[model samples]
Target: MMISSQKVKVDPRDAKLSMAHFYVAFTALALGGLAGLLQVLVRSGKVELPYGIGYYQVLTVHGVLLGLVLTTFFILGFQFAVISRTAGTLSNRARKTGWIGFWIMTIGTAMAAAMILLNEASVLFTFYAPLMAHPIFYTGLTLVVVGSWIAGGAMLTSYIRWRQHNPGKPSPLLSFMVVVNTLMWIVATIGVAATVLLQMLPWSLGLVDTIDVLISRTLFWYFGHPLVYFWLLPAYMCWYAIIPKIIGGKIFSDSLARMSFILFLLFSIPVGFHHQLMEPGIDPAWKFLQVILTFLVVIPSLMTAFSMFGTFEMYGRSQGATGLFGWLKKLPWGDARFVVPFIGMVAFIPAGAGGMVNASHQLNQVVHNTIWVTGHFHLTLATAVILTFFGISYWLVPHLTGRILTKKMNRLAIIQALTWAVGMTFMSGAMHAAGLLGAPRRSSFSTYGESAQAIEWIPYQIAQAVGGTILFIGIILVLYIFINLAFYAPKGEQEFPVGEVTDNAERTPMVFENWKLWIGITVVLILFAYTIPFIDMIQNAPPGSKGYKLW
Candidate 1:
């Protein structure tokens, strides 16, 4: 049987704070969605804009605003709500720190966005070395990073204080998972922090004559792959700890769920070098090792899939259904909260398969810089991550605002999710097909002087443009639903759904909460994977290259 919690009234101040973060996140979604629409149009060679807005500029905006700003703000907001509701109210000082972090992030985003808009920082979101952006751009992003650190610090401090008061008890599952994600972020960001503060910022400011490309890229991938996990873990938290409850079931195994999260913390970072399989200057042996580690990280995902399917089977059987796949038919298909994220999980199946292909050294060569890679990540990040975020928003906004989510709004949300799925199916499918034909990514035009191979890609490019337009409309609909829910809906208290463990025969072991042990192992694994390769790169490095403005 499913266990349910009594509705707890959120503190007014905390609700408002979470709402503030959501506002910024949704605003980023709107702006970034527009940029995404324009990008596909321009790349298709079928549209032009006034005011000299180049492809790279729009691309940078799309990546930074959607990839970085939207995800960070949303995660922070969601975690704050989860922590506050589950672990009790934060101290006044902690709340103030959160507000401070918000402002810092906002100011930093504005600074970087201004530079990109002025065409001063057309370097894409990766901002790889030797193609430098303005110093302010790097500085602004630093502030954003630091702001996130401050926010995470506040959350972590609250958890520590809670643990001190409630010794010998398991922390609330949602809060525990939130802290895990925060700690993972703390560990993963060190590489990018080192790269930006020491290398990119200095070089952009002319404090350094040049910067090493290989070293910079290595540092980025060190952080980059974990960044995907950072985006993913929150969604996983919902799936494992909350979604089952929404679907009339409990999580299959709390102990196994905790173990899966712990495994993610241990395996996520050291495997990032898999992104560098095609890059030169990195040792192939090191790359192969990371590839093995990459496959290891997939274990947690498989664990999650197993737990989720088990939960579904139990629920279905409880409802008197029987058969190999009868549980699938018993799920709550009409509930927008369940359906939106359910579709995201379905999309992740293929996305995860694509990741394995990308990690393979031989397979990586075929799709390394191609649109296939673009399609792969679009399915993962855009469809899987973003769709789950939308699902969360549907309920989260209502919960924070004390609004009753009407049936009409829920229906609209379902429509939005379906629209997004349809659009992505068209766009990503075409991207993969065109990429197999040697169509390049990150280009304004792929015609290559209208060569035959390039000519074959045009239809797919046009299809991508059409798909993007549809996806933009879906995003706009989501934003609209959020605004109405937050500002205009009738006031009511919404319960936070925290799933119970189906297995009562066993308790979560104390070792699952031993974060220090996991963190130590994580650091050691990172060192083992990276230490030798980094030493080799720096010791045998060529002279660094000067910055350029090729666009």
Candidate 2:
């Protein structure tokens, strides 16, 4: 007897389920944003949440939910959009699995967030031992990460299967980036899974006497650093693939896009110790090596920035606009896709670049565990990533729903993007100042004490508080626009405008498929991995020595 097999085709434009997926991601993001608001407010003493747990729990939940869960779902949906067209019969299953993963991940993250907010598990989000939380929180988070892992699996399988059937045709640049992202996810999470399932879980269950705080942190950051790239890649992919089209130009160099993706895959993981710059027991040499790779990775990132911006210049010229960046005005500012990425770039450059400075071994000591660090991350991840997701949704959902947004709503989105960008900048600036003034992070309020004025963090704290209010208003506006788009936009009148399709879909041949790209990526990762044992050396050294081992 023979079994019958059938092929199924899913419409990429069938965004009804896509919209549901995005909403789940969006709602989680909004909750995280709310948590951020509360954190800032509570830290500034503007209001007390009355939770028994310290503010660190609130900050951790906000970071994990928004940065990890929301981003994972958003990336999953975005990846589907990029790959579905070329994925043949398996696209339907991929899309279905994507939505399933979204729901599971959202529910898990929500459960974890509720636990955090309810003051049940206040242990900070790190993998360090002796600071355990309620099992429910860890279990919820485990499910959330597991859901993302499944989504990554679906993406890899679908892309690989597509390539197998098609033969000799290279994967799309966007699809290749997704593959790299999936690879990084698998590699990074090994530590998290080992710690959570083997160490943390066992410890929480009283099966272990003590957990190795040093090894756990090492593993967590091993996951944490590259995990950042995972959040940023979709935005960067848009920067590479979608931005050029938005500007009505071909990408400056397709090779550059691929190069950047591969670089992220290789170097992104090894830089985890940069987060441990202030920690004990890590080898100085390994930290130094990571610092070097961290700096090296910046080159590809800057290449992306230049190429994407170059397209913007070309776009302006195409529109008959003149002068440097003058053509920005020629583009439709009301389009959320365009507006969000623009804001993302403007916020990312300074914040992300400054992050490299902090990533340096010595400089990290200066700003270690400071508010400045928080400000820097908020700039790239919170401000940039969230905006990109909103922008992509604006372009995608209308096409999916077959609805045209009201002209007013479009303009409001632009306003929302602008407001968010500006608000984040203001707050982030204050945080930098506060950090310099010795205002440490993970605290409910500035502990500058009676000499607060002397410490000079008070003024900056005031600025952060005010900036938080502005950010909250801007976020509310954004949520309102999306809600209206989903619920209020009349189904009959809603249609994605025509010109926008051709605006970004036209692609030139990608040049990054050759051996050169692989070699470059391999070299970077090899260099990164070579430095790992060095960190262990530092952990074994005597006190005050360069390689002192402190766990």
Candidate 3:
């Protein structure tokens, strides 16, 4: 049995820690959202960057601040708060550790942002090699990664302490999900951490004249694809555990949710090769193997889809809804908390389709390196993950701030979400259409020597600018709502919704809590997938390439 509460507030101290993370996250959202708008304008050929700013510079800022900074900070903060709600309040030591981690990350973000501002690190989000940035940029990012690890320690400490205190009972669902994501994050980040610390850092500092490009890229995608899941699982947590509660439904199946998370841990890391399907140096056999693993990762996502639909349908039918689609009408459509994330859920259907296209070798060739990939990323992360984050924030921000989400703000949030939906449909749809016509990603306003195909892309680019502008408006609305909630909203008890498992659902097995078993398999799977190919790339590599400062 779970603790049943409609108005459990996170301890005030814990709330402060989580709010600190949110402040940074929203600041990143403001800056990164601005960078994103500018990028679209430049790409559309509507406006040139006025300050001698390179397109890649803005691109890096947008990707790093939004993709890395915003996601990491928000997820950590949300996790801490949720864990405090479910497991218990954090210990004095853990809370202190969280503050320290927050400061380190903030300082690191400042360092990295300063470098990007100075045009010292314009090597976009992937930071793929032969395109080196300042050493300090790498160092700053390293600290950021380290800071996250320390923060994760605080959450993990609480979870472990909970288990120690209560023998043989199932852990809280949200806490369990957080543990799974945090562990996966730790495992997946090792690849990037290795490349950065051992390879990129040494080369960037001029200690090495050349870096092995293949291995560096290999390491990146190794960290890269699972990074997708690292972002997605938190949203999934909301979908699986939190959303059900929000909509007045029990979780469809506690065991099913746990299983999907475990499957993600096992399969997400080995599938990085799908991202590298277009790159050479790896054998076709290994690429094929990893693509197969990529499909395996899809299973969990589908399971989550199945689970979410079931949760909603069950709740609907219980409320007297009938027919195949009646549940759609029964959900709380007016609640921004439900509607906003539901839009994200709908977007994933196509986003998942686009992913399948990207993962398949034959199909990937058509869209590889095209703006279609960019569109796919935006749909999945920017729309699906981000919109879900926004939905969570509506309740979460105020829930922490000791304030109620007023109806006026709730209506505004719904409008904000709709604006995002419309904007993304235009922007991403145009990118996909243009990409199929051979519009390249990561390039700014090229006419390609007046080629016909190139000219065709210009219209789609303009559409993206239109869409980007709308999305920026959505950002502003969200920030406005955030500010009111944090400082001025009326004081009240706001619930932190955690779903109860359906009565018919079977008990969650304690085996899921056996970290040694799950983690051991995770390690084995990663080793099995990467060991041979990584060695092959390193052993039979081409001459290393020297760094370039093209920007």
Candidate 4:
């Protein structure tokens, strides 16, 4: 006997949301790309801008819009899909709340961008303590955070309601990502809100003359770093769950996939301090503690990457893909989502692995606050994280529009991915070299003397600019391809109906719910954090103390 359950087709209306969100994300990328170009122009002396305003403003805009708005809404779409599926019915309330959240967040994001443009909130989206912003900036940011909080809440409620009705089966993988993202946002934003309410807002409103800056930055990074993972998890979910299915394979280990998400939720939170490793005042031992946890945090990423690639290789061989690298050819190269991760893998080997070295306390000192750090993150964020979003867009668009994507558009997207990979790799590597040579980041001018005493290397900065130009072109191509696909692609093909394909075989029902696994991981991980407060006492210095510096 065979079992059957109803699966709703993806709604055509959701296409509007996906397309709208895509515009936001892609436009943000475009602005960020322009920032890259400006940096190059300044460094190369190709064109002189009025002030550092051009670069800094763009940088601030790019980071906040891309990091907060783009990622948040895109993930919201993914959440909608999951809610529609696993919940058996997508609630009208969730649908409405999501759209409302989208609009509110968009307004907030625009205000935030305006703040940067007007130089009101150049504090960076990290919104560190004591560095107050204009009231509109904070208000705008508050709206954005609140909207996302509501959106996340809606998702959690939907999932919970669905699980209550569907009891006994583990939630589907897509839904699981939505749930995890919601949990992370809830946990992540607590710090952001606290910083805004207790620190930045108070100071900005003239309630306090001076505030504790370290505490504010500490809380902000706590939100910021894991928030990176929050954005990336949706893409990883697609990688683990959908990409394999597209390639005609099953997940290598469902349990491992579950564990991976659980670990990410737990480990990513406490380790944000790693980003501040080079700052003064923090104890060396505490910094070292974060460094160790940061390294430990890489385990889940490696595990997920290995598991996903392993699944692909196994399927490629099963489909007669032949030997080691031969699976490369056997992949569904025509599929954009499939190719995105394929290229993502190429970058991660260098970026992700090298990133581990960069995260090390000693290595970070060498590279801290340098172009190397920028390169490391851009590779990971752009190559792996943004690539995943593009992949999901490919999958979502047609499903939303009830149309099949043109093969040409998919091919071009792959080209864009390759271009981005090449560009980011070169740019980031140059930045790393510049950093190692003691070239500072966030500076519009190096002014290296003839001896190059203060500014050791200028050429690498120029290299970054050139590489950034390549990235700019790549980003433009991506946007152009997507725009054309949405507007120009003919609607002749049958709508891509959502459901498991014929090749999707019957599998045993999900019987195991190892809540203990996650709980255990949480307990073990906190053992590492338990020593944070005491770290200064034992090391004889608080974090950021003069004696506790990494550099």
By TM-score, the best candidate is 3
In model 4, how many backbone clashes occur? 9
Clashing pairs in 4: 280-544, 281-543, 281-544, 281-545, 282-543, 282-544, 282-545, 283-542, 283-543
lDDT of 4 by residue, 1-551 (tens): 11113234555555465456666767777776676577667765456767547655656666676667667767776676656655545577766777787788788878877877898887754655444578778878888888888777777777778677777777666666677767777777877888787777867988866655666676777778778788778777777777766676667766677668877877887776678776665677777777777777788888987887788787788877776788778888777777887787667777777678777777777877776777777777777878877766665665566555677877888888888878886788887777777776666663444555444465776677778888888878877876766666666442322223224334434532444565466556645653464354335543443222322
Pairs that collide, model 3: none
TM-score each candidate.
Answer: 0.97, 0.87, 0.98, 0.88
Error of 3 at 303 (Å): 0.9
Could you list the CA RMSD of all candidates, in the order they appear? Answer: 2.1, 5.6, 1.8, 4.1
lDDT of each: 0.87, 0.70, 0.91, 0.69
lDDT of 1 at 445: 66
Question: What is the lDDT for 476 in model 2?
Answer: 88
Ranking under lDDT, best-scoring first? 3, 1, 2, 4
Compose the digit string of candidate 3's lDDT tens values, residues 1-551. 46559867799999999999999999999999999999999888769898698889999999999999999999999999989999999999999999999999999899999999999999999999888889889888888888988999999999999999999999998899999999999888888888899988898899988777778888899899989999999999999998998899999999999999999999999988888887777899999999999998789889999999999999999999988999888899999899999999999999999999999999999999999999999999999999999999999999999999999999999999999999999999999999898899888884363567767888999999999999999999999999999999999988888899999998799999999999999989889999999888767766435223211
Between prediction 1 and prediction 3, the one with superior lDDT is 3
lDDT of 1: 0.87
Q: Which candidate tops lDDT?
A: 3
In candidate 1, position 357 carries an lDDT of 88
Candidate 3 Cα errors over 4 Å, as ranges: 447-449, 544-551
* TM-score, cand. 3 vs. native: 0.98
Q: Across residues 1-551, which tens digit of lDDT does each residue of candidate 2 receive?
A: 00111121225443554566677777876887787888888777557776464677777777776777677777776676555533433366766676677677777777777777777666765635666766767777788788777777777778778667766665666667777777778777876777687767777877766666666677788788887888888888778776655545556665567778877777787777788877766667777777887787788788888877767776778779887668778876656667777888788888777787788777777888888888988888877777887777676665555555677877888888888877887799999888887678777654445464534565676678778878988878977877777676756433221111223433434344443565466556745664556465435535442221343
**Lowest-scoring 10 consecutive residues by lDDT in candidate 3?**
542-551
